[model samples]
Target chain A: MSVVIEAHNISKRFFLGERNQRAFFEDVSVKTIRGLRRLARRRLAPEQSSSRDFWALKDISFQISQGQTLAIIGENGAGKSTLLKILSRITQPTTGTVKVYGRLASLLEVGTGFHPEFSGRDNIFLNGAMLGLSRKDVRKRFDRIVEFSGLAKFIDVPVKNYSSGMYVRLAFSVAAHLNPEIVILDEVLAVGDTVFQKKCFDRMEEIIDEGHAAILVSHGMAHIRRMCQICLWLKNGRIKMLGPTDEVASCYEKATTHEVVAHYEKQTAEQHGPTHPSAIAGLVQWSVQSKAASAPHSIIVSQAKVTFRFEIELTAMISHGKISVSVADAQGLILFTQQGELGQITRGKFWATLELPFLPLKPGEYIVTCTISEADHPVAFLRATPELTVLKDESLAQSGYHGVLNMPARLSVEQIPQA
Target chain B: MAQTSSAKETRVQSVPEIVTGTNDALPSAKPTYVVDADKILSSHPKDLWAYRELYLLLVKRDFVAVYKQTVLGPLWFFVQPFLASLVFIVVFSQIARLPTTDLPPLVYYMSGIIVWTYFSNSLSQVASTFLSSGTIFRKIYFPRLIVPFSQISMNFLNFIGQLLVLFGVIACYKLSGHRIELSLKILALPLVLADMALLALGLGCIIAAATVKYRDLNIVVGYTLNLWMYGSLVIYPRSAVPAHLQPLLALNPMASFVESFRSCLFDTEHTTVQPAVIATLMTIVIAIIGIWCFAKAEGTFTDSI
Candidate 1:
């Protein structure tokens, strides 16, 4: 396949603060006055202005051949939008160059040039022209675009009166029907209802199958895995990783989960601030451990025996205290729960452990919570440190595993023979 | 093309040498784009040609959309200059007793105002290209020139409407026993209008580029146009100015166009070929500088905006 896009060492720098808003003439005059002052003082030191510099992207380079789908994945403010803008030629990079070999249409934003005052039909032509399609081309694809948007009845109505969803559908429909050899999409797929999203996915798949090159920026890891062949993970304006979609997506997902867990830990600590460190009686420390994993926060094998341990420091003794352990997924849905009675406990620093013979959970992030209650009222709530990550067992590593469950089951080959 | 390449070499130090020097590898006859920090000149003029359809559509959209929802619609175009001219007749001719040439006061003030309105409208519209089109410019990439070009086109349509009204006023004056000269020199109206457009586009481009960073230019532009109209011989004929101030007034780029317009329609004064020639030359020079500044700004204006 011939290379359709080639970018070399692209870097973008922006001035931060009030200086960016200064007029060109004002900036020039001020600089000249500053230089005169320096000359009058005969100072040799370099002049430093008040404005700070921010590099939105730094030394980024990549290439995409025909028929290749490249996905860019990163957290917010990770310079993903900046890169797309540069590639689409909406903005120039501070340094470096990009060469595009064919007709390129970038849908960085749907309804980009749509005028709300104009009817849907008029906006279709306007948007098409903005996307580099001629009037004749728009005329040819006019019916198909309207049909795809399913707004045939409202084609002659002004878009401002249409619902937001209808507006997006029409804008996206015009872009989807364009016959550009290279396309750049920036989170435009995460729009409309599920049915409409499915149509967009099918349209994009068809475009890729027709041997067109594409660059996509999306937060959906599943979409990236399903649609893209190559992935570029950006962190702090630099390429963190670049390789096959499965490899890079998995790494990005892990890093993101770790960040999420760290954030959650910080929030929980803050919520527990006034009640912690000086509390007369509460759970002080907790850890999740499994024999199949080295790290206390991770489980490396499927169906591993796991232990949820907690340490309690109480000023008074209790006779009817209860300890409960619950395992929850990332969405905070409690997947498993068990309670145990603590018979007559006089606590200084008492260790409590809840052991599971087998943990029937998939290879993903999960939070284990422990609660200590007396007389049906909870006194302390503790979450395991570092969260829990269930790594896939290499022996059972198959691509078919779906959803968040790894329950052990046996398949019987004795089939029911019905004539 | 040769001039552009040479200009690229002499200026724009950061511009890279063409990366795809040869097109042997391209499988089809598709256009290629080379985007760089300083790649300012190449392919834009061609892209403008290729996007002519878009240009026409934009002009149509702007032209239609301006009056699309108005009750009076395009009738406002004719009413605007007519009313403005009536106000000038009251303030300048009737109250201040400014000397109107041999032409009727209505004809004189209306003609000058029509031409000035066209010039100012084009200038201001083109000047605000970035501010007005910043939304579309940020989201999509097209030949940015198409926007300003379309704006001037729409303004031209507006000018045509007011021009027809001017002619009607002139004809009415002719029927009412006024010996207003309808000279053959009127044939030069198209060239005069084109010259005025070039001047507007050129000046607008420079201001648009400047205002991207210093929005104060926008306010300056508003009042500067008012001051500029006073300087131009729009309200009064060139002869009405003190002889010593005539040279200073002639320094205004628009003086000759207004003078030529009056001479062409009513022969109020014989317009010398020299001023028109000099003004046209100045317009071309200003236009070149304006286009250069605009091209440089388009690459990075989105960042500032």
Candidate 2:
């Protein structure tokens, strides 16, 4: 298939600055002062300074084939709108190049190119022609456009009087009806209510079915997954990942999760150092003991024995210390916490064992954090080590226990005869 | 067409297959960076030609909508200037005793008002083009120049309508035993109107560009036009200025334009040829600057607006 749109290393830079009042005044004064001084200075001066440049899009490159839909998914400020503007030719790129093979119609913003003083009918033709449709084409599709907009009665009225929803509906109808070879939409589906948004998505599907290319920039991952076969995840103005929708989305989710974990680690690192006078400093190690040496890294609830060993370094160890062990779910809801009494505490190395008659947690992941404190002052703390995982038991299938937690209950039912 | 279709199909298949298989297998086409300035410039004229029908639709809209709900309808085009000329003739000529440059006071003031009306109307409307057309400009991709161009054309139609009324007054004055000499140099009236339109458009483009970002230009434009009218000798003759202020007065381009227009229409002898040349040069210079500013602003005005 032929590539309908190709953007190569496209970067857009915008410079923002206050007007140079001093330079302007000095230049004006120099022009007035006259003679050979201005001539000599002009010959000697280097180029003038521009203010500061902000990179809205930094080296973004992608290509779209004809009849293919490429979905761009990113958080706000990810340069989606900037890329669309460059593609639409509404703005020029500061660097790099974008080549579009055929006619491009961009619905970057709804109700663009609408003259409010003109009647809706006039604006339809005006906006249609602006989108690259000829007058005859607009005339040919005139009735269908108005019908789609559901504004047949209001077509002759000025658009300034249109309700916001009616205005967007009419504007979108004109854009879709114009039928340019490449369509670029930027979050315009968020306009109108749910029913109208569905109508728009249906229309977009129809347009795609007709074998024209489209680039959809949307925040809704579900929408992208549904409508687009290919997805590009943008991070900080560059393509983070681009490929199949599911793969790219999963990668994006993983990267976001890692970011959150990194942030949490940074926040917790400053509070605590070490609890006891062990050789290793600030290290709490927990491992599950199994006959199989290559058992999966995470601890399961059905494990034979779980050992939590705390190794801490003491700056100056004098007296009593207690170690608290807490198990929490993913949402940081503590299911349980156990405090080893002072008699159980040794100088450096601390070992604790908790035995369960039956594993309490069903099937899910959980975290275990250890806090070591002396008289309520936290001396050392460590978050989850070998993050816990619980697997579903096939053996328990007959018992009717089907979830993450197993609660034993007995019930007796008595049937009453109904007439 | 068949080749395009099959090629498009093949391209579509290739993209997903290559992407799904391996990223390294994709075609190695880097972006092109030739920067075709001619292509950009030609896009404007091409769009104008392609969108000609829309331009006519806009012109039709300008004509009908201006007089649509008014009581007098299109007749007000003639009624407005006729009444205004009569008032100017009475107030500025008879009451204020302003000097008329070798022509009847009514004919002289009416000629100036006729040309002044076209320039002022075009100037006022052109200044508002950015704000007025902001809605349309933001949504679609057309040459931004079209709005102001269409505005000037619409005002041109109104000026021609009012010109007929001026001709009737001139004919009536001729029949009333006053010798109204007809000069062949009156053929130059179109040139004067063209110059006025260009000058107005250039100034309007500058004002429109400024108004998009500053917003204060809108207010400044309204008041500036009023002050501008007094300086242009619209109500009185250019010769009425004191000799010392003549050079400064001559610097106002509209003064020379109006004076030159009156000379052509009324066979007046006191024509400021030097000032007219300066005014024409100024107009051209302003137009070039305006176009350059507009081209630079076009890229980012969407964001600012």
Q: Pick the candidate with the highest TM-score.
A: 1
List ranges where model 2 is wrong by over 4 Å.
Answer: A16-52, A116-118, A157-162, A190-193, A255-419, B1-42, B62-87, B171-186, B207-220, B238-250, B269-282, B303-305
State in Å the error of residue B305, model 1: 1.9
Please write out the lDDT profile of model 1 over residues B1-305, one tens digit for every residue: 21222222211122222222223464453438877976873246878998898898899889888888899999999998889888998999999999778878888888888889889989998999999999998988888989989999888889888888888887787798778878888898889999999999999999999888878788888788888887777888777889889788657779888888788776655556788898999999999999999998887887878
Lowest lDDT block of 10, candidate 2 chain B = B5-14
Error of 2 at A358 (Å): 23
- Candidate 1 runs further than 4 Å off: A19-26, A29-51, A277-387, A391-419, B1-31, B41-43
TM-score of chain B of each: 0.88, 0.85
lDDT of each: 0.79, 0.69
The 10-residue segment with the lowest total lDDT in model 2 chain A: A272-281
Q: What is residue B213's positional error in candidate 1, in angstroms? A: 0.7
Report how far residue A56 has shifted in candidate 1, in Å.
1.4
Kindly report the interface RMSD of candidate 2, rounded to 1 decimal.
10.9
Pairs of colliding residues, candidate 2: A1-B10, A1-B11, A1-B12, A2-B11, A112-B139, A113-B136, A113-B139, A114-B136
